[model samples]
Target chain A: MERIPILKLHDLLLVTIQVDMHDRLAMTLQDDLMHQIRRTRARGVLIDISALDLVDSFIGRLIGEIASMARVMDAETVLVGMQPAVAITLVELGLSLGGVRTALNVERGMQLLREGSPEEEASGHASIDH
Target chain B: MPASTIERLQVACEEDLVRVRQRVRTMAAEIGLSLVNQTKIVTAASELARNMLKYGGGGETEFERVERNGLIGLQLTFRDSGPGIENIEMAMTDGYTTGGGMGLGLSGSKRLVNDFAIQSAPGQGTTVTVIRWK
Candidate 1:
């Protein structure tokens, strides 16, 4: 059983999706991500899909589910490094990953996670900015 | 002019969906489709292949290289012999799924390509054909 490695960096979990994942592998990723969250108690998750050439509806739904699951577990999930084509395909596939926050790249994604919610930063709520 | 066959593959199980995406990408790239175009078609193929396996109980896929009017394109057809769609109108609608999916298989695939055709009847199975021009 090939497994997707879940790396922990401080309070964040980083996942890079590089393969054309099969159904079982997707399920395994979800299960493992959940367990890792419980064990590491990470505050944020960053999923990089830049290398993924194709992501179907099943995978799309699973991503949405992952974000929701992370949210329930007291963590925020941000997806980054999505190619332009993947964004278009996801829209056509009827998946916007509504709850999953997105960034242009891992740099921005990491920034988003390091602090807190982007919404909070946007509304001038969090006054911890230097 | 008849489209030339590029490749063929089996969609017998879940893993076959990955094969479908891989083959679709290879043929799309062979046809010189842009990266965005290749991703769109491959994504569409992925959704359709999964539909065939999960609902149609397995099927086969054929890839074709189409050239017409100085434009090149890639075409794919998926055929299955399991239970067919009971109502295509409803099935084609977004957010309709009989197999616990997000119901993006039909309508979404249609949006990804330039040409789309689907034929199905209850208990007679389903066949979907799609084409994307480069």
Candidate 2:
């Protein structure tokens, strides 16, 4: 079985999708990411899709699902590095990726995660202690 | 005007959908389509191909380089032999799906391309043809 490697960077889980993914691969990634978030207690996930030139409805739905799932799991997901062409097409395809956070690049996405991380605030300290 | 055949491939599974997208992108680029146009056509191809696989039990896709007057464009035709759609109008409606999907395949793909056409009956198969001009 093929899998997309998920890397833990400090308090964030990073996934860069470089290959053209099949339906099964996308579903697997969604499941695996949720497991990793629970296992590592990661606060944020950054999915870089810079290499992908096309994002159809299926892939678009999966990304939205992953983001929503991470939210329910107490994690933030920031999709990063979407090409301009893909952006244009996705909107026309009638999938605006509502309720999903997006960043121009990885650096900005990481910055967003850091700012939004629950561990940064004093109130968050109480939750981390549990 | 008569269209020139670019390529044709079978869409039998998930892997074939990926191949269809890649080949459509390559063919779109070869015809000097802009980046946005190329992306739009490829995305449309992906949606239609997947629809054929899930609803039509897989099918065939044909690509063509079409010229109407002085404008050049790319056209795709998806044909599948499965339980055909009974009501295309309802099927094309957004958020309407028989399969467990987002239901953006038909309506959304139509928005992504310039021209869209569909032919299907109760027992017969379905054929979708779309074109995006550069």
**Which one is best on DockQ?**
2
Per-residue error for B10 in candidate 2, Å, reads 0.8
Residue B117 displacement (Å), model 1: 0.6
Report the error of model 1 at residue A44, Å: 0.9
Task: Give per-residue CA lDDT, model 1, range B16-55, as digits (tens).
Answer: 8888888889889988999889999998898899899999
Cα lDDT tens digits, model 1, A87-115, are: 88788777888889999998899887766
Q: Is the docking of candidate 1 incorrect, acceptable, medium or high quality?
A: medium
Quote the positional error of residue A80 for candidate 1 in Å: 0.9
Candidate 1 — which residues are off by over 4 angstroms?
A117-130, B1-3
Best by lDDT: 2
Give per-model TM-scores.
0.92, 0.94
